[model samples]
Target: MRALYQIAFLACILFSCGCSDSNPSPSDDDNVPPPSGTSSFDIITQELSNDLTIDIYVPRVENASGKYPIIYFNDGDVFKGAIASLTSYKFEASSGIEPFIMVGISAAGHRYGRYIPYNDQWIKENWSDYSPGSINYTQRLINEVIPKVEEDYPVDTKRRAIFGFSLSGLYAAWAGINYPEVFSFSASMSPSFWVADYAIFDEPRELSNTRFYFDIGTKEWNYYVPMIESLENLGFRYGKDIFYYEVPGGIHAESDWASRLHIPLGLFLNGTPEEVEGYEIIKECIPSQSTAGLVFQRLNPIVTFTNGIRYSLSTSASFQVVSGDGVVLEDGRFDTKGGSMTVEVSHGNWSEHISLNNCNN
Candidate 1:
């Protein structure tokens, strides 16, 4: 079943991209020469400990001169290759992604040693080989890494961001809240939020101007789902820049992270304040756990709804439009119950495998 889904996805993606002109008509300034984006490296905090390599990607515009926002990425070595395509795509397409100075800080060879926060239970158990150095790492980034980058490049101090994946992703959240003065935007894609026994959730900290983006694959770990929910319950207002997303079939891998990187970047750079408002999910029938051979419709605003004549005979079957928090915003029994409903949604995207099963029984 997953294979068929992939096949359909690839077909859709290819068809969409293939149908569009590779080079759409350019804008007025399109003729201008592109910036001389440079990639370079430096060793940070040489005095205290092992030197950490920071790979910086600087985007230059030909005639423009001003400070640009900074996005510091964990796992710098991996993005050394991934950054080019991203910058190039921004230049080639009209996507709202902005070009910022991206600094990739390399994770230590012993990732668990540095990424893991100090915890007695974890240290005494499976992570005995490593000691937590998250504080030291965060210190180096604010004191050494940012200062070093700022020394040679123009940076927008007001709009700095830090992001990461997996273990380092956990670090992004810890550092963003703990040190809000240094980072305003923080994103953790598929973060190992369960680490240290959910220690981040144990204590509350004062947050000011701190925005967080947390996302993970639904297929990854069912237990991890509530970790994000706890963030919402802890007073991170959704429209106020704290957002959470779930990729239906996402996984813990670089490819999946790369594909969704634009979502966070877009939200930070050019997000529309009203995009999520009035968004609705309309479902005709909730599929059974063992249901199969069903047609799953992708969630969209323009989806046409039929009366579902085949299942209308059953009086007990129902329909619902639930919010992300599981609140039944709108619901009713099918047409057999003499109920009427109309839904209007806009500017939100969700992927759910909807199926109709045993409704006629």
Candidate 2:
């Protein structure tokens, strides 16, 4: 599935490039040069007891004198390669997206501890090897990393954005929420919001000044539903101050995050939303053969928008047993009698019919 998505994403990029005649060919057009950029590695010892590596990418803007917006990434080493590729593609395409400086802060040796908040009980209880010093890590980023980067490069301080995925994604959200004065925008891809049992919602947040971009794959929808609800409860209107995308078949992987990097970049840099043309209903179920008949261990009804965003309606959608004495369980599972069963799931205006056969019989 990951390979398929990666291929599709790459194909989309190639197709878009091929369709545009305005884009000059690399061989024929010396006037239009490829997007030029330079990257350098820096070591920061002031922030932590040990040295930390920072990967920075600054795009060479031709004749543009203005300071550019900057994006700081968590798990810097993981995303360092994608940053250059994504920026080059966007720059060459002239997609109306502005280029920004990207700083990848490596997790170094203390990822689990540094990514979560200081003194997080969840980390203590779950990860036995959880190191301490998230507080120091955050302080180092604000007091040292940001300052050094700004001093070294021409950066637009007003448009600072933070990017992270997984645990780092949670860190990004926490940073934007807690330190709105520092980061104006946050993009969390497949954030592990289940951390500390959704402790992020324990207190009210003033989100008027902060913008957030969140996305999760349909497979990971169960973990993010609470965060989505909390954001809505906090008055975050989608496509307004916050953008949420539930990617169909997206998993907790770097490849998935890299594929959708353009969405948040375009949103933050160009204020453009990935346009939604329509939506399709996808029905999925995992069935296990029982002694009596067959049972569905999981029932997933996903609504995939044309824009590549997917929403899981499994828990929210209404389900009915259409035939064969099948019953929809309270836990959203399905059980069948001897022969076969069919279920119809409806959410809003979308509906899908899922059929399950009792192969055991």
Candidate 3:
């Protein structure tokens, strides 16, 4: 999928230092032309003696600029290439929706060790046998890689963020809390909160300037609910700047994360990215209309309710919606989703397919 990001609530990023007359800055996520003179670069830092490596994607907009805003994705290299794939990268890069220097660190070998917070208790419990080079790996990211990126490239140190999925998501949050000076914004996708029960929020230091984005699927697990709720209940607002999304059925993997990437980049980096303006729930699948073949060609399958509100029933065949009239309906929603303009429906012993290609709202 092709995607771009926006620069929302960027009071912190403006100070990152890339906007200088001597050196211009990169374009915003919109892919607008750089304001002339912006330059970017990539650099590898092996100075920390930690056997660490990093791949930096500079915006090329930070020319001669002292510092450019940064967005670092932990295990980004892994999340991009094979595990998650980089078409997402090509999409963002080419589309210019939300553009910034993307730095991807190779966590190919030691993901578990570096992503998890390592303390005495954690070491003994979740990481019964600690991953040998994990903490050091994170240290490499924090101390070795970041500083080198700053030194080697013309980037604004102040305007920066870290993000990733699963363990990497966990690490991105940890880095923001541990070294707020280095990164001011953070996002975590489907984090593994149970790793040590609120250990993340209980970091040793509090970053007065840090803004965060945390998301989890409603059906993921019990831990996510409490973890996110606790953060909200506590005085941890991070205020209007913090972005939170509760995906109804998000899972734990790159595919799941990829599908939802737009949320974080929209809400956090760009503030409610979807164009909900001219858009409304065009089709609230009547729960009664649900059936076995309840899917429209490419749209998200949904089961409409009597009130006209539609919701996804189940992608698999194990579930269906029962209408008030006692009619078992296949659940799903429809829209100008694909070229087919058709919906499949099915229910116990009954089946019907409907054509919604004419739906236009």
List candidate 3 stretches off by more than 4 Å.
1-50, 60-67, 82-98, 119-128, 131-138, 204-207, 228-235, 271-361
Q: Please give, for residues 1-361, the per-residue lDDT of candidate 3 as tens digits.
A: 0011111112232212111112112112212222233233333333334435666665434333445556777765445532222223332344444445667775645555567775435434423454434457656666677777777666666667788766677777777666777677787876654445556645534425667777755434223323333444544542244554545555444555655565445444443232222211123221111233333222233333222222222322222222211222222333433333334354333344445542332
lDDT per residue as tens, model 1, 57-131: 666442133777788887664434333334554432344444577787766464565566756454344334566
Instruction: In angstroms, give how far residue 321 of model 1 lies from its true place.
Output: 8.1
Residue pair clashes in candidate 1: none
Ranking by lDDT: 2, 1, 3
The candidate scoring highest on TM-score is: 2
Tens digits of per-residue lDDT, candidate 2, 142-255, equal: 887898889977888889999887667778888888888888899988765655556655533654577888886654443344454556677866456666666666655455
Which residue pairs show backbone clashes in model 2? 246-310
Q: List candidate 1 segments past 4 Å from native.
A: 1-50, 62-65, 78-85, 92-95, 120-128, 224-235, 272-361
lDDT of 3 at 186: 80
Roughly what TM-score does model 1 have, to 2 decimal places?
A: 0.63
In order, what lDDT does every prediction score?
0.52, 0.60, 0.47
Off by over 4 Å in 2: 1-50, 62-65, 118-126, 272-275, 284-361
For all candidates, the clash counts are 0, 1, 44
Residue 238 accuracy (lDDT) in model 1:
51
Q: Each candidate's TM vs. the true structure?
A: 0.63, 0.66, 0.54
